[model samples]
Target: MDIEMKKYLTLLLSGMSLIGCASSDDLSLKQNILPLQTEVCCESASHFPWFRLQQNQDLDFELNASSPVNQFDGSKSYFSAFTFAQQSGLVEIRLRSLMLDGEVAIPQVELLDSEFNVVKTIDDAFTVKFSDAFAKNRYELTEKVDTVKTPYMIVYVKTSELGKKVVVPHPAKIRAQESGEPMPIVTDPTYLASNNGHFSLSVETITLSGYNQKSLVEAKPEEVAVVQKPAQPAIQAIPETQSYYHNAIRQAVESNNIDKALSLLDEAKALNIEGAQEVFVRAVNAK
Candidate 1:
């Protein structure tokens, strides 16, 4: 080869070697971030607790000072980790933290594959505030993960979300709305965000057959059995009272005292003397 061509090939090989070194350095840095202790907590994917999440079952957990701290991103925070059981399908995860004394945890999730590699990072969880009569107000996060591809998950609060507050309508307003009463104007309550708190996690598996069945059931109108009420016994008229009112109204009408006949009709109607109003109407029509 020419001298110039030889020089160009040498430069290209040097650049390729530098690129390989940089890639190796990045991998090593990632491996070094794994937590040293495996028994106590999950700083690494393989060290995560084996959690057999049943379909539509909720698992309650608490993160306090004793919880394991993760500093994988250069910020110290507590986290909960789990590895799904075999046969887990398309999984829907719901995380909830009740607002206790105006404090709660803001949760973010990371989905990892079986090989301890992160497949997806769900940092932007759409959180919402929920209140119900049976429980205290709480914050909820719902996200779906295909467990067949990503079977591991980690729940944690990012450092940026720490000290943030979630504003929600006051409990008084919610109570008023639920009770169908006039709502009172009150300042909205705020929940202080923290990295450690009490939370519950629920998992639901979705299958095509199950979803189709549910849709069909919902689309079908509910059957309401026609309940025929038994007929009430007829009220027998008191012959004496009925005769007295009828005779009085007819006599007044015959005497050309139409006003008196109408007055008598009103009294009979107040007394519930049946057929009195009909007699008055017939007399008026005839005249």
Candidate 2:
């Protein structure tokens, strides 16, 4: 080979050798600056965590204590999506929705195109649980492969007691529009103690060494508003008694009117009915 070509080959080999010797610290420095696909976990103090896998990465995300799904890790499940570093390749991602005591049966996934067409859907997945009490857990992860498209992808997950559903849209890139608003970024999850009976959804995220994923703090999932029906009034039963005052109070109790019962008791006491005071006090205490 010519002397010039020989030098070029030598330099190329040396550069590869230097990369092979790069440490974890060196890799962190290059993160976001370059899309290197590895297991990126959420730090303990991370408030909002959601990230997109690079084109070179083969979907390597899982939920655990150290690498929790999100801010509300232990008690709630999490869901989020990130843009693919590239614009034209086909990649797949999995959504794992967790529940406490019992496993959630159907974990539906709807993939929509830019025009909002349902391109793919998953109806159900098997329930999984940990054997040990320390596990005290139940989880439902999508077993099917979700085809993630370029330009963007959408993820839908179910969570909480009634299986509240959420829709997440992940765009291909973070373009700072004139309004300076970024869509589908992390949202602060509600804090609640971990319960074996509550279902939770969460997503993990990380910051590349120099890469800033545009996040809008106010962005939240467009969840369906839940309307809570008012609780039915308790039907208070009257105690069987021969005393007139007691009977009057019982009538009020049966009608589920605390105010009427108290009023009747006061009248009975004013009339100097024997034991009226004691009966009234008892009814009020019972209520």
Candidate that would win on lDDT: 1
Instruction: Give Cα distance to truth, residue 190, candidate 2, Å.
Output: 22
lDDT of 1 at 222: 9
lDDT of 2 by residue, 1-287 (tens): 24653454355445545566776445423321121121222332122222433444323222211111222212233233333332223433444344322223223444444333546554445354432342333444433232233223333323233233222222211232434666545542221112112223232222222233222222111111112221231233222112434644654443344555555555454444566556545444443
Q: Can you write out model 1's per-residue Cα lDDT over 132-223, one digit (the tens) per residue?
A: 75346776778787776776777766557665777888878888998999989899877667655677777787732232221100111101
Native-vs-model 1 lDDT? 0.57
Clash counts per candidate, in order, are 0, 10
TM-score per model over all chains: 0.52, 0.26
Single out the weakest 10-residue window by summed lDDT for candidate 2: 217-226
Stretches of candidate 2 off by over 4 Å are: 1-51, 56-81, 100-107, 129-136, 142-152, 157-287
Report the Cα lDDT for candidate 2: 0.34
